[model samples]
Target: MNKLLEGKRLLITGAARGLGLDFARRACAAGARVVMADILDELVTEEARALAEQGHDATAVRLDLADPDAIDAVAKFAGETLGAVDGLVNCGAIATGIGGPDMCELELDTWDRVATVNVRGTWLMSRAMVPYLAASGRGRIVNIASDTALWGAPRLMAYVASKGAVISMSRSMARELGPKNICVNTLCPGLTLCEATEYVPQDRHDLYVNGRAIAREQVPEDVTGSVLYLLSDLAGFVTGQTLPVNGGFVFN
Candidate 1:
């Protein structure tokens, strides 16, 4: 590893497993001190401990992205223990199960929950950590978005709306934080094969796979490199951009 993030402190949300975990592992390998947080406290702790045992500077925290209080508490804890955060990867999200509901049929509660975690959570997490990021002088933020937002997939209205909000929010944040040298960008991944995606309908999965130019399913690792790049010094001049890592599923 080139240690692109040497001495950097990163706080990644939804890192118990899947793509978030993959990002933590890669960031640590690149010499970052990582704070991996998730709603699943036990899993996050165990994963962090395992990484620590391997000589990685890793810590785990219980974080409920939907709760504003929890977001504040986690931010404070991270700032106190890890010093200023140089990077934040907002990878936390929620998916609407297939055949659940359409836009007109979608329940308000379900929409609220998805938006709370996927959209509001990203906003709150980034808001809470901005002070710390600003203090670092080289802050980097990578918000996880989805290709559905770009293509306007049917049936998954709430999820698509939430991710669309994330992409818009990232661009606004990037513009606002540019003066502080804080790079804010969005990473939109297609129908990736992860634990969360298991709930997606088979027809939907097939649609993504067969329609992709590459005709290959995406793995969690496929998105980590773009994230790593955005968080490194190499991306200092990049901001307010949405980088899709979806294997050509949706082209700009």
Candidate 2:
């Protein structure tokens, strides 16, 4: 809102809908040019076009995190389209319908799939984008982890495990990328009311609301502010940090 990101160029993954979409919109509104990448090609394209109509610099490209080659291509396209990347929001993951199966009941394939998309995907995407970020001189990387990783939510071991890995990876990346002036951090969000979380049982949602210090259902906005700050100059000195924005549901 304060043009904090003016002239910044960013790449946001999983931006077709949900929190990723909101991040893209808020970044654009804050005066940044962005490339929105997702597996939902058509929807991301439409969303980017709408942002363009609103006088924002935005573009859409399909990115399948499961494919390393696809990740490389999208990284290339985003750098080309934006001319340079000042920040990357790694918000894409296999979150929908990946619940219900307990650790013992969870199939091996399901675990692999979640790791492939959530863990490996985040790593690869970050790997692909580091160059553009290095060129920016003041780059930022925001990896979207989950509060479930901290709380150890049951019956969702794969997703929870992958998010934990993300948090660990971000810390390592911060250490490795610090010399390059790129800040890497992780945001652990609570059970947000989004399209992806629609399958989560109402009982679990109630549990989150009741346990939260704020005593309200989490939304995309609750987490987006942390994202903005991490990507802003104010947070340039901060890296390898984990911020849990789950209404005090869990502390780091």
Candidate 3:
């Protein structure tokens, strides 16, 4: 609808479905050339094809956040194909299955898995894309965090810790990348009902809806507006900030 991102090229990771997919769609609609990268190669390809059919500039690439090689390859593909990567959306994450265990009962492997994908992955992707983004002169990076980190939700220890690290990392990154004119920020969304969140228990979902200021189930679209603003020129002066899109679930 609006040409907020016209002529910009944005690369989104973990874009096979859920919030990442919606971000790709919205960015494309906002006149951006989008590169949808995901570990779910087939699904991401189909999504990209669908967007192309809609007459949007969209393409798909395979990326696994845990693999440094894959991250580098995708960054190379984006540079060669998109030319200038004006923005990056790190939306890929791993959460425990429904009814995650308490930290005392959580497996070390599970903790490592979540940290590797959620924390390390975000770092690697950002590091790999710095050159391309910095070259754009007005680069933007939006890391998808969770409100659980702020609210200190119980049981989901690994995920909460991982996102907490992301928020801290975003601030440090903003300070480091500011000289390059690349704005880095983190967005914390409440428990959203999306394909990626199907593992969340219904009771947890109900709790979120009932406790929210809006008293509604948070959805992917609810967070996209903040994302658009962060990536748009309007937020040029905004960086190293964490904005919660959880409908008042946890007020700052």
For model 2, state the Cα shift of residue 113 in Å. 0.7
Show the colliding residue pairs in model 1: none
Query: lDDT by residue for model 3 over 1-252, one digit each (tens)?
Result: 488989889999988899999999999999999999999999999999999999999999999999999999999999889997899999988888746788799999999999999999999999999999999999999999999999898998999999999999999999999999999999999988789888778899998998999999988889888898899999999999999999999997
**Runs in model 1 lying further than 4 Å from the true structure:** none
lDDT of 3: 0.93
Ranked by TM-score, the better of candidates 1 and 2 is 2
lDDT of 3 at 158: 92
> 122, model 3: CA deviation in Å?
0.4
Alpha-carbon TM-score of each model against the true structure: 0.97, 0.98, 0.98
Where is model 1 poorest over a 10-residue stretch in terms of lDDT? Answer: 94-103
The runs of at least 3 residues in candidate 3 whose Cα sits more than 4 Å from the true structure, single-residue gaps closed, are none
Q: Where does candidate 2 stray beyond 4 Å?
A: 96-99
Provide the RMSD of all predictions against the true structure, rounded to 1 decimal: 1.1, 1.0, 0.9
> For candidate 2, lDDT tens digit of each residue in 1-252?
568888889999999999999999999999999999999999999999999999999999999999999999999998888876899999999853534866778888888999999999999999999999999999999999999999998888988999999999999999999999999999999999888888888899889989988999999988888899899988989999999999988877
Instruction: Please report how far candidate 1 places residue 32 from its true position, in Å.
Output: 0.8
Q: Pick the candidate with the highest lDDT.
A: 3
Query: Please, what are the lDDT tens digits per residue for candidate 1 over residues 127-182?
Result: 99999999999999999999989999998899999999999999999999999889
